[model samples]
Target: MVAQLETPILSSPCRVPYTVEGLLQVFTGSHRSFFTNVMAQALRIAGQGTPVLVVQFLKGGIGQGHEHPVRLGQNLDWIRCDLPRCIDTPQLDEAETKSLRDLWDYTKEVVKAGSYDLVVLDELSLAIKFGVISETEVLELLEQRPRHLDIILTGPEMPKAILDEADQITQIRRSHRP
Candidate 1:
């Protein structure tokens, strides 16, 4: 959902900003058994020669995750939003609530700046699901973001709007073995 603004005529020809191709990758599952692998692959492939940012909600780092210990590259940037560990049970005091909003604002700034080539919104679905941030707000930010910016959103219970807007969607479902 890209918003097109009216181009202002300049006395001299205005320098047109370089339009970069962007893609959104969505990953959802109750059990992210392959979250790290998918994330690592994304980083390994797209993260080269450009900056990558990971905004983690609930868990801080790869090591902090409950699953396998995932190793991150040196150049990757990490921003952890302190949300309740479980979406089913959210415990947020006034301070944490403020912090979550602050983080959301900060993420908007980063995305708007178009500084990073790739950005991963880890567990962002949970944040939206739990009302930490509104889906409409996020959608607006995404719409206004630079074309060159590529984004990846991870977590369970992704909204239909998000899924609809995503270029690619991966659902990692855990099967019940007989």
Candidate 2:
């Protein structure tokens, strides 16, 4: 099931100041289930003129597998890393790896510039483990991120380094059992 935020997260008194420093939130577990839950949370935090960038790291592309681009308020920008959107093979080819690198570079630049109040690296942890990007590179970028920018990383098997730095770590278990 998709997890839903109880209410507008930013409007709460306990909300962290978006510009004070960078924060990392990691969400892990069932892909479809947790992705739904994380997006719900992002939507809640995106109000009040906060800019949000969503980088979809993995998605289906062909026949019966198209994913709707995620968007909330006008401040939200969504980019899908897998285009034509097919699933990756067990191993990525040279071209695929380069594409992933380019995406990572773009994400890094966006975070470094502090362009968005919130940046969601959807399925990024899985991408890192798949060798699409390096965990070291991600950690370095996180280290340099603008103090005020809040980031959300989602995907199963989150790396220990990311977990160490995350302000919140949520594991969304699947509700349905086979």
Candidate 3:
């Protein structure tokens, strides 16, 4: 039944909105479901024009290891930012801290280059929770983001400041099944 429903969405052409509000409207429900739909739409739109940079937030390999499911009519340059390989917990070793800094620097450089159409920062809330990435750094990135660039930051517990600045914000709550 699920496969049957997804077939049509997967087969349909990509049609993503230009505005952040429109994009938010497209994914108004649960995080997993919203992300799946958003990625599909982003991939479809990306195929039509320039490449996209997808920065996936890593949190125990949620949503299939940062790789977008390859469905028909999907096209986009997906770049996954898994963060420092080490230091799974909130407390990080010296090396892990350095690596985290390196990751942020690399991301800044990429955004400055203005090459990608979209950049998905996945599991950013975890970074904040663990003190891996500072809110200041995120704010700086948002302020410096290039025009026409689409940035998607996912995960639970998003900062109030970031949410305020976001053009679109979607909250995914847990659902209990019998």
Candidate 4:
């Protein structure tokens, strides 16, 4: 269920400035998994005036020819950075590493151009864990983000420093195993 805030401002038509800090606090209070929906609602409401950046960190199965139904309904621009292709996996050889790094570098350059309203670094946590991308690079990107842009980071095991600096942090814990 979605937790409703009682603040009058929340009801107002004005765009609400949601930070990572506020979202973390809210998550601590309720165990509801409605953050994505809530965020979508908030963005829908806020989109009245300013553009909303809805960054999504997805694991595998992104470019497997199946279109994402949920993402299709959204109104913002969608830019996907295929994690497996962008990063060096354990199975990758030396030649693959160079190719992956090249891809990563190219993608980062595009991201640095600041064209999209929302930039989704899909499965970035795993990329960082696997040493495909550097945490410092992400920090720099966040620091240099455009003033009007809203950044969202998703994936498993986000770094503490990143979480602390984020305006919001939501941890999705699963019960059933694959």
Candidate 5:
């Protein structure tokens, strides 16, 4: 049976995450290889004992959704959508649309719970651009996120609003191999 998602309620103040200042960081580029660096960084952070959540907004085919998180070293939680293929365009069937929405809702719930010190939203911009996810809801999530939860958003065509709130923005460009 499919697990029903309950309405998210944010009232806990349990974790203070080992951080003084939680900053919004953005990494965007034309190359998908940039994700490798981010993953390495997430692993490093998790190794340091910080809880990290890495959500791949548009990636799937592994049959893993919010309920089945791949835990790496007890600190990092990696999750993706439950769709059969990666989302490339806006068009989606009813089932695919519901799956994507479930992931988003689950992500928001975990973020609200302060379950992770660092959260990575991978390929999120593409979801937003494709109209699978609303940019306004993302903004609301940012505004309501825990004070010490550092978030790193990775994808191309990031919205200006998100860029404006970013404490640091890294834009990658393709270049010939050295």
Candidate 6:
């Protein structure tokens, strides 16, 4: 379900002079949950010609890698691990581990280069929790990103350091269905 905006944003394909210098936001929730609104927001920004990068750390099974990126509206780039299957557990083969590391490295390099105005790191917490990437490195990346870049991180049970660094936090909860 989508949150009702006080005012609807009509996309007439115009450039928006973004006001904020940068923002760090976190969306934490249960495992296997879909962050539809986050994705929607990213698309909306990208549709307006703002650069958006969506990195899915744990999702794979699709054989996606840094070499191949799915571009949307010429402003959004989506990348996933180059693994044979979606990583759901900590146990990974040597090859699977290497692929994840590659994606992480690529993500950092591009982000440090200020390639995108908005970056959505999906399941990044899990990558840290699984020890594929260190939390300290993630914090350093967040700290070192371009000043005007807005970053959104989504996952379950985000590390305290990441949460503390967030400018805003949105926790999703499932309501009881009748």
Model 6 lDDT, residue 76, Cα: 94
Q: Give the whole-model CA lDDT for all candidates, comma-separated.
A: 0.70, 0.72, 0.58, 0.49, 0.88, 0.87
Q: What is the TM-score of each candidate against the true structure?
A: 0.75, 0.76, 0.64, 0.52, 0.87, 0.87
Among these predictions, the greatest lDDT belongs to 5
lDDT of 5 by residue, 40-110 (tens): 88998888778899999889899999999999997999999998998887888998889999999999999
Candidate ordering by lDDT (highest first): 5, 6, 2, 1, 3, 4
Clashes of each: 0, 4, 2, 4, 0, 0
Q: Model 5 — TM-score against the truth?
A: 0.87
TM-score for model 3? 0.64
- Predicted candidate 1 versus true structure: per-residue lDDT over 1-178, tens digit per residue: 1212334555666655444478888888877555696567556744454667777665632233222223356556666654444334466667566666777788889899987767788888877877879999989988998887788898888899999999988999877899
Backbone clash pairs in model 6 (N, Cα, C under 3 Å; residues 3+ apart or in different chains), count = 0
Residue pair clashes in candidate 3: 55-120, 57-122
The residue-by-residue lDDT of candidate 2 on 1-178, one tens digit each, is: 1121233359778875432445688888755457776677667666555678888776535322113345557778777754455444547777556656766788888889988878889888878878888899989988998877788898878898889988988888767678
Model 6's TM-score against the true structure: 0.87
Lowest lDDT sum, 10 consecutive residues, model 2, at: 60-69
The residue pairs in collision within model 6 are none
Better of 3 and 4 by lDDT: 3
Give me the displacement of residue 95 in model 4, in angstroms.
4.9
The lDDT of model 1 is 0.70
Please list the residue runs of candidate 6 whose C-alpha ends up more than 4 Å from where it truly belongs after superposition: 1-19
Residue 141, model 2, lDDT = 88
lDDT of 3 by residue, 99-134 (tens): 556656777787778766566666666677788789
